[model samples]
Target: MTSEGTFCLVLHSHLPWLPHHGSWPVGEEWLYQAWAHSYLPVVELLRRFAGEGRRDVLTLGVTPVLAAQLDDPYSLRTFHEWLGHWQLRALHASTLWRGQPVLRELGAAEHRAALHATEDLETQWRHGFSPILRSLVDAATIELIGGPLTHPFQPLLDERIRAFALRSGLDDTGLRIGHRPAGIWAPECGYAPGMEDGYAAAGVERFLVDGPSLRGDTSAARTVGSSDVVCFGRDLEVTYRVWSPKAGYPGHANYRDFHTWAHEVGMKPSRVTGHQVAPPDKAPYEPALAADTLRLHVKDFVDTVVTRLRRLRARNGKEALVVAAYDTELFGHWWHEGPAWLDGILRALPEAGVRVTTLRGALEAGHLGPPVDLPASSWGSGKDWRVWDGEQVADMVEDNAALQRRLLAVRPGPLRDPVLDLAVNEAMLALSSDWAFMVTKDSAADYARRRARVHTERFGAVLRGERPLPLEDRVFGQLDARLL
Candidate 1:
């Protein structure tokens, strides 16, 4: 328990603007998976921590695109229906497995989880964006940082797009959360040499970058172009300690396989046929066995945290911060047992006496290391921005870039006050991650095309000044003239 040991479990929550039609590959389903694993469960975990009166700050990032969905009446209604459906499915699961002792117990747990998930969704929506989470930010239990208006790829984007989106994001977030965010998620954690100037204009004090950006420099923050905006790297070693791309604990052999698929039988549901990754063994998600698996991973993670932090106490003698940031979608969506794993990790981190802090909280205390410049980088694969505008998605990126430039020329300059709202809309429309992800995954080509067309067209409309309504110009126009 050294004074220097501290950690920030920073979870970045975002989905590339999946509105009414974004339900298939890159839309509503994405929300359901994230809602199931990351948001609801994370909320419960933080709620428990708050109830325990824990003083630690756990950072939760809610991107503006995701915020719009949460605030949308249609999305909320859809989510309610999704919740109700899952509840019934859980009941079906319980009844189907009633004869098997172990499976029955697991089904019962799912049923309870289903019920809790619904409550958590409503609770979060009831406040516009998880009042508990918002409260945590205000109380500093969780540092609430936001991303761009629609979570765009910044470096490759036109600077105008970067300015409009980030500024609008700050404004919307302040409106929703009731306070200004101290840190920006930087949309995919993307950063470039002079991008900080845009952040600086938006009154952003700090942001998240990646390791290569730091280039082993270990500098916590550095200024750009006379702007005091500081950027922090993802602290890779500590982050990989929990969820590495290929070697993290979640991928262990004994963990409930995430690749398994199931089919509901006619009179009797068939057992999980098998796992695709681990092929030949498909036992589905057995909570009884999975609990042991979760415990193992949690202990290993906490042990690593303790060992690393202890070494930090010896090396730096300053408040040592291990910034372990991750995609929130990883918790429940990608990893089947992720929610349980997160619950285990959160509970374990505090009990082991490790200090948990957020990006904002960590900055408040200051860094001892000298400020070294970070390279242009992101939290994407290889700490590069390839996923956003790689060769596969280059055409899409170029199209958006050209559109962005035209929009700026026709509508507003970055410094102009009149063009602020239009800039906001086009900025958001350009940032939707659909096309890039579609190009990357290769399975959602049509879905991506549809989304890009939708937003790109929306941008064109704004540029032409054909749209007069605010919410509609931004979010397909809501009833009663409200901006969801």
Candidate 2:
């Protein structure tokens, strides 16, 4: 049934700086996988919708670091090479697994996926992502959401540094996307009291927070504390319906199993046949079964949104707004069928009589309410800051706080020092909330700790007035030359 309320989908797209980082299990390979399986397919899907005249069907947060990587000349070259390697790996897999019918079929599917990604890259993404992404923003197919330069958790950052990060990030967005964004994803939806003022000063008119931030009263957009900037709380009820930390749609039995990777090529080759099934015992993936499952989940999600909005309108006696946010990488990167599902949902929502709007569009439509005081929060465990600051990551917290103080104290001269500029860049990367999150979750904990240390040590060296490390000098010199 039709409802007067609106539903907004916010896709928060972000990845840490990975150009010079390691590859394989993590690093540049991570970037390539997301680019091929997630970004390419997702953007192409959005383009298809735009062809049919869809506008603002969803909101997208493409963090500045991610944007830089997509636009970088070095990244473009390496990504092309990575795509070639992917196809080669698939070809080898198809040949090597010939005796095993199921494995051979899996290899063939991966080969087709690789070829498709290569073709998309050549036709649409050959030049760079800036122009294509800008076109979408121009067409209003999506509203761009900017965030801090390196996805720093603004809540814990020093006030001035936080402001600089936000302002610099917005400026970068303007440079790359042809306009400054009016909204931001706020780096993990992490919020501290009075951050509304920081966002306001940076000219960001709106942001998102966890539903608990608004005390779960997300019936309408809200102005926080004393600031006029609007805040939209992510409705956990709707978001978790698709994917949550512990469980969600991607775990459906018919979907591709992410954990059962092929030893030779590291490609996933099995379906999530059952929760208790061993990787070796899991059934082979079947596209037909997955297609059927996708339809069911899509309908279930659309129906859920309709029912929730209808109930919310009835309870409020007014038009209500619901925002469902997620990481953009989840689509093809983690869930093999994610892009198709997204394409289906975007088309079905409007047909089902549900209104699709960007968070900015919602506010402009006047779906707003009085100011509310928000509690310090994040879209993390316990709906608070524990994941980034709890016992597991206490050392990281101390190191980040120390580095922020040191970096802020040493302002760069008007004439840029390549050393200082590079140091500042590293410091920003070090402060990324991803490190602490990985540590807390025990996922890639060692890599996370090492990355945190390397950046901080580089930042510390520069702060101590020491010369840039040898490797730093060579790397930053090349980057400096490119800027000129």
Candidate 3:
């Protein structure tokens, strides 16, 4: 390698519990879309790279909730059904776009893409995602990282529940992947003053945070709160070049526009022409052009990493680390060209003198620095907790706090109560960071509000010695508190 400096790409993959929920544009559909698009393609690409002997391509953090759903029998069966429906939708689009030449071309491309995805899912992902992910981890092509159960914003959670959630999440990952993870994503990169104690107890060695959380000194990994667990900060200057909400590589003209949809067929038919262009006025998506654009982005990112690492090395007078972190859903799901871009960058970086490693790999490579008294922080809006505990969702914050207290106060008698376990899980689900994020974004505000309320209600009911309402027809009976 031309430089000893390392570049770690941390992909945080997470989604709240969504099975048995609504579909289309949200809920289980969200999981299925990400699965078929992001998860399947990204995994396949990683496997392909691994076959060619690539190692430490990236660190992948798959939250426990998402893992549970992906590994669940129902999710596997239902996802296949969803993929079949998606292929049919493309066929319908082909028919619907019969006359217009451009539309017909777009329909053909989408149809072929859907067919390819379905084939991949049937052949590789037929069983569950764990096997596929486990294979990658085994090959050392990627490091698998775990997160809290349900992906809660950990800063606001009670210490005991927080500790339990983190430990339980790692345990769940161990059960699925055949070994416990030594690191966690820390649920939204949210960190509190004393979180390192829990993380230390949970056996986490390192985690990623936003650059601002490190006070803009993200050139090296730093330990937090006297714990040996190192915290790496995301190089926003590198990550945002591909995926910022306002402008990023995804908004480039050649790529598919995520918003404009062929409603009848449930396909995106337009390219991102210009910011002001209405959906109807947007030009048809051309995969060939998008492929070329993907290459350009891949080269740009590789160059950017090379430049950043060189500068950091010079400034620090030693080998430095630059961590670029992002949501794994960005690939294939959010950005149609994301997986290709990832493939290109990984392939291009090594050839360009930038060594790619996981966060753990960086630490192992001796990128560690001194321990710092880290503040209560998160990677959320304003580099603080506003997106979750701000004025807009104050009620939710209170509700979560109250539920945590109630949950911790519950006595399970002498035996492990399955009902208590179920209720506690529900309460934790309600505290997921996704709901507050959704509410703050106003995209799925109502659903987020309802979900939070439902979980709290379930916890309350269970605590009051009453049975929570069943999903379908089954009824839960009251639990006896005096059984001890």
Candidate 4:
């Protein structure tokens, strides 16, 4: 597998801050899913790679909200408890899976895998956060990216609301890791015409967009229309090869169905009948066929990435970069075997003579040929803002407009500290997608509302002149307790 130039893999990891306001089968659960699936597993894979003495240079955008949760003593504690819960569930599942003869041996294997994963979590937590990710960014193994404080859909929100979110995020990340970031994920990959000025203000020199955002400007990095900040878009072909709406390699029939979940609570033993059933209604846990299927899926996905990258290599005589970007949740969270696929592919790329690199590493190598005026665009649906703020999300727009109006009135001044804090806090909550998602069930609406309410209340208390917001520690403490 030959790569044209410096190939970069960027995984944007962000979910609206969902700590309290537990609303259900979806709410705080999303956080748990990320912890159980994506965060912990990916950390394991990367750490394992690091321990092997191979420097796996990859770029992953972890938003400030997520990073805060990660570094927070509260969040880490909750993460530990979640891991323990997963262990118990796995044990529960094993009991059910062993009942089936054809899957008994497979169930045993899955049980062993689960146990191994649980044991690995402790070591990963010990490996520490600043080193694995922060150190990588410091040493330039990874290009770190931040987003609005709570991850707001820019362009839709007022300039100050958006500005505050951006500032808080950049500021917080710096506080956490002791380094300033140069790029942001732009929540939902959302962007506006003049957002770059704020990026410039926040010390962010770059932001990501879709292929169309670059609009025929095939260069390493292109400047936004009349703006100094650089913008880069995802190459749909390379990205979709691994993740797409209908045809991504992850949907292979052989692999486990992410939505199938647990019917009767089994450790292993899937009940998929080819690809005819909806994910929610699928059968019990099945690992026998799932493992073989995952193996093949990983092989095919690696081949697809290799083939397309090689073709790009030959087509573009000059060294060109083939970047594969995706949501971090897709791995471990959406596709159960995704981390395995990633681990396999990351290893395979170098073997095929493709130099593994991160966004920062690649950009540092050289500029994109020349600069073209990039369009005002995003990586959303059809490379637009429909995914986050489309025809379907109008109500959420109205809700935020009022919230922003209220916040703009408060203006962090000399009056009351609690009043100002509440306004700022709620303003931050207003930018989150939880409420909007709750309004639209296309995703986890219930969980969305719960999360939205969480930040809103936190902001309200401070605004009510509670100055210090006594409940802050209580709320955060519960999160800490859950971890233990």
Across residues 384-425, which tens digit of lDDT does each residue of candidate 4 receive? 666566666775677667667766665454444544544565
Given candidate 3, what's the lDDT at residue 245? 54
Q: Which one wins by TM-score: 2 or 4?
A: 2
Candidate 2, residues 140-205: lDDT per residue as tens digits? 999999998889888899998888788888888888878899999999889998999989988999
Arrange candidates by lDDT, highest first: which order? 2, 3, 1, 4
lDDT of each: 0.67, 0.85, 0.82, 0.65
In model 3, what is the error at residue 56, expressed in angstroms? 1.1
Per-candidate clash tally: 6, 0, 0, 14
Give residue 141's error in model 2 in angstroms. Answer: 0.8
- Candidate 1 vs candidate 2, lDDT winner: 2
Residue 196 error, candidate 4, Å: 1.9
Error of 2 at 306 (Å): 0.7
Off by over 4 Å in 1: 97-101, 122-124, 217-227, 265-280, 313-319, 350-353, 412-427, 461-473, 476-484
TM agreement with the true structure for every prediction: 0.86, 0.94, 0.95, 0.86
Over 4 Å off, model 4: 1-3, 105-114, 126-132, 138-140, 216-219, 226-228, 266-273, 278-299, 306-316, 414-419, 437-441, 446-462, 466-484
| Cα error of candidate 4 at position 266, Å | 7.0
